[model samples]
Every structure is written in structure tokens, then in C-alpha cells.
Target: MAMHPLSDTDIGDIHSQLRELRTEHHDLDLVIAHLIDNPPPDELLIRRLKKRKLLLKDRIFLLEQMLVPDIPA
Candidate 1:
């Protein structure tokens, strides 16, 4: 969905959300690594975690784009 031009407050809120998503994404990275490092890892749980991480990554990218104004060439 295309968001309308955001007010400063809205942008701030978005920025906060971006930080939270990034933190979660980083935590997921650690969790995923631990899951892989342990023997007899639960493949199903790892797969789910990986999928969640991907989704969070996508959201982070989108929010970053929204926060940064694109420069025209």
C-alpha cells in the first residue's frame, strides 16, 4: 500500500518501528545460529524461524525506503 506523505510525528513512529524490527531481526539471527549449532536441531522450528526472519527483513527494507527520500538521477 502506498502511504501518504507522513508528518514528522508519523515519521518518528516509523523510525521507531524500524529500529524494533531491526532488533528483532538481529535476535532472530542469533537464535537461528544457535539452533543450527546445536546437534539434533529441530528442522521444522528452524524453518519457521527462518521464514519469520525473512518477513521481518522485508518489512525493514520497506520501512527504510519509506524513511529515506529517493534522489532523482
Candidate 2:
């Protein structure tokens, strides 16, 4: 997936988003770890964090898809 068509601003935006997503993922990891260590987690908080992690995963997937050009048959 070539990035030539993307303008500088577009590339910058994507980079920024990726960074933010990574940061969020890292934070979630810490939370999950803490829950593991402490035991007896709050169901609601766990569910919410898992949902957010999935959402971020989807966003990252879409961003990656944007880099790939569609092939015609």
C-alpha cells in the first residue's frame, strides 16, 4: 500500500491517530493487568475497556485499509 496519494497533512493526521490509539491500548493493557493482579474485577469497567479496545482495533484496521489501493478485476 503506497502512501504517495496522501497529502502531508493527511499522513500527519493518520500518524497522530495511530499514536493516540497506541497510547490508549497501552493504558488499557495496564488496567487489565491491574485487574488481573488484584482479582475480583468490576464487570462494568472490564466490559467498557474491552469494548473500547475493540473499537480502537477497528479504527486501526480502517486506517490500514486506507493505505491499500483497490484492485480492479
Candidate 3:
């Protein structure tokens, strides 16, 4: 199956989503760090947060790739 190219609006929307995901990923990092600093942190919560952060990282990478044009050699 062939994929359609993104329009200007679609690209803009993707950029916006990328920014939000990056911000959330950074925020999660801070929260995880803080939680670790406190004694006897909730292991379950930390694990969940780590999982979410990983997912966001993946999404961010995908969006970034979409922004780049493919060149034929």
C-alpha cells in the first residue's frame, strides 16, 4: 500500500504534537528523578511512568522521521 504525503496543516499538527510529547517526556524525567530521590518510592508507579516515557519517546521519534524528506540515491 502507498502512503499519502502530508499537507502543510498535517505537518504543522505533527510539529505541535512533537513539542507536546517532548515536553511531557522531559516532565516525566523530572518526576521520576524526584520520586527516586524520596525514600521508598512507589515501585509500581515508577514503573508505569517509565513505560509511558518510553512510549512518548517512540512517538516523538516517529513524528521526527515524518518531518524528514526521503531522498532517492
TM-score leader: 3
C-alpha TM-scores of all predictions: 0.86, 0.78, 0.91
What overall lDDT, based on C-alpha atoms, would model 1 receive against the true structure?
0.90
lDDT of 2 by residue, 1-73 (tens): 4345777798778878988998898899899778767868887888888899889889988886765665755
Candidate 3 lDDT over residue span 8-32, tens digit each: 9999999999999999999999999
* lDDT winner, 1 or 2: 1
Candidate 1 per-residue lDDT over residues 1-73, each given as its tens digit: 4556778998999999998999999999999999899978999999999999999999999888888765555
Model-by-model lDDT, in order?
Answer: 0.90, 0.81, 0.93
Q: Model 2: runs farther than 4 Å from truth? A: 1-4, 69-73
